[model samples]
Target: MDLYFMGTNAGVPSLERNVTSLALRLLDERRSFWLFDCGEGTQHQILRSPLKLSKLENVFITHLHGDHLFGLPGLISSRAYQGGDTPLTIYGPQGLKRYITTVLELSESRINYKMDIVEHDGGTVFEDESFRVEAALLDHRIPSYGYRIIEKDQPGKLDTALLKKYGISPGPLYGKLKRGESVQAPNDKTVHAAEVLGKSKKGRIVTILGDTRPCPAALELAKDADVLVHESTFLHELAGIAHTYHHSTARQAAEAAKYAGVKELFLTHFSSRYKNNEQMDRIQQEAEAIFKDTTLAVEHVLYPVDR
Candidate 1:
């Protein structure tokens, strides 16, 4: 799995950053890409990368803020033009259905694909065979939420050497054994699958937070995550402003990462005041001072999940 930052700016678009949009690419996994937010010009951002818009199966919106969801209507309309026929599911807070329905009604946009919109009340939002997504309320100016994505553990690989040692030749029987099934051999002997398989591999955990101040709910949602993607709208020097605006400072995000036991911290949703990347580097340095495994999120950068 990999995370691609399409936009990193907090409130509005700047020359350096767009808005708040992220794409969770799962090419090698069971599902396709799952988008966290759909900020303005999100389709244009995807065009710059190798991502296919049709493969976007799920979209999770943190809030109704323009920076987080302004690109949804346009992207949905554009998908029809791009010949997207697969079904797409969208999960978000209340009023999401009304918002999208109003947009579609006013614009007369006809989507060629099936659209499933789920209005959540802030808890465990979604769960499939591959992953579980949970949401928690945060201390934002608006009703924002933070999401935690926990991937399911994968089954262990089958030990071919052990199977061969048991006089089991490679064939459909090997497939059954790999699936944890007890099968009878040609000599009418029972072979157990657990004895020949390796230990199961642990799954990866990724937590993505929306705009919010330092809150206990956010920390709880991001506990022990492999990567914690938190918004840092201000520098440590402007922490007072961050608190007033219901946003987090770089140092605050780092502290949250440390408290949550996150392995890596990705600071994003930068304020528009900083035009150059140097300010981001400085913010990263300040965060790294608190938590060593911290970095500033950049647009179009893909971060791989080290599972």
Candidate 2:
């Protein structure tokens, strides 16, 4: 899986960074992409990247903040004209359904495909054979949320060499073996999948958090995650301002990553105060001082979540 950063700025658009929007690209795993937020100019950002709006199957809204929400109606309406015929599902906070419905109604936008909107009060929102998604509230001015995406463990790969020895050529029988089933050969010989399959690999975890101050829910969502995408809106010296605004400093984000024992930390949603590269470097240094595996996540980059 990969994370495509569409926008990295916190509130408003910048010359270099747009507002807060990103996509979890599942091309390798599911051949689809799930969006995290729909900031302003989000569609334009997608046009500039390798992501296709047609492959966007899910949209997750963190809060009703303008930067995180204003682009939703536009993106949704545009999806229809852009060859998006597949059903789409949106998950968000309590007022999201009303907001989206109102905008689409006023605009008279007609969607060509089925769309499901789910408003949750912080808990498990989605689950399927491949993944489960849980949400928790955070310490933001608005009721922002953080999502924990858990990929289910898959069946181990079949041993090709062992199958060759058993006179089992690759065919429909291979599918049965992949599903961890025993199959009988034409000669009346049975072979067990457990004896030939390799060990199952552990599933990967990715946590994407919305705007917030240092909070327990943030750490809970990030616990042991392969990738923790957190917001770093200020420097350590301006932590009081961060708390007052219900935002997190770079150092605070790193501390949370360290306490949560996450494998990697990608800091985004930066304040526009850090304009130049030198100023941005300060934010990176502060986070790295606390957690060495921190990265200043940039816009339009694809970050991989490895198993």
Candidate 3:
């Protein structure tokens, strides 16, 4: 899986960055992509990137802020004409349903595709064979949320060499053996799958947070995540401003990443005050001082979740 950042600037768009929006590309796993947030001009950002609107299967909005979801109605309306005939599901806080339906109704837009809006307060968002996503309340100005995506463990690969030693060639028998089932050999002998199976690989965990102050729920949702995408809207010097605005500083974000034991921390939601690249680099340096594996979420960058 890969994270394609559409925009990273907080609040408003600037020459360097837009607002908060990203797409999690799961083309190899599901042949589709999921979007997080839909800030203004998000679709315009997608036009410049390798992401496709037709492959957008799910959208997870963290909050109801204008910077987080002002582009939703426009994007959804445009998705209808972009070969997106598949059903789409959107998950967000309580007021999302009203917001989406209201705008679409007033605009009188025609949607060729089916869409479902899930106004989730907390708890499990959805669970399937491949993944489980859950949400938790975050410390934002509004009732924001953070989502934890837990990928299911994959089965171990079958040992073809060991199976061949048992006088078994690739056939239906291979399927049974792959499932860890005992299979009968051609000579009327029984062979066990465990003797030849390799170790099962553990699943990857990704935590995406909305605008927030460092809180306990953030810690629990981020525990041991492979990737933790948290908002670092301010530097240490402006921490008081961050506190007043219910946002996190670069240092506080690093502390949370270190405490959560995440493999990597991507600091996003940069305030417009940090205009140039030099200022942005300072934010990363501040976080890296504590958690070495910190990255500033640059606009239009594709960050691989794992190598």
For TM-score, the strongest prediction is: 2
Model 1 segments beyond 4 Å from truth?
164-181
- Per-candidate TM-score against the hidden true structure: 0.95, 0.95, 0.94
Give me the runs in candidate 3 sitting further than 4 Å from their true place: 161-179, 183-188
lDDT of prediction 3: 0.92
Better of 1 and 2 by lDDT: 2
Pairs that clash in candidate 2: none
lDDT score of model 2?
0.93
TM-score of 3: 0.94
Cα displacement (angstroms), candidate 3, residue 261, comes to 0.6
Rate residue 125 of model 2 by lDDT.
95
Clashes of each: 0, 0, 0
- Could you tell me how far off, in angstroms, the CA of residue 106 lies in candidate 1 after the best superposition? 1.0
Model 2: per-residue lDDT, tens digit, 1-307? 9998989999898898999998999998889999999999999999999998899999999999999989999999999888899999999999999999999999899999889999999999999989999999999999999999999998888889878888899999998887888999677789988988889878999999999999999999999999999999999999899999999999999999999999999999999878999999999999999999999988888888889
Model 1, residue 256: distance off in Å is 0.5
Question: lDDT values of the candidates?
Answer: 0.90, 0.93, 0.92
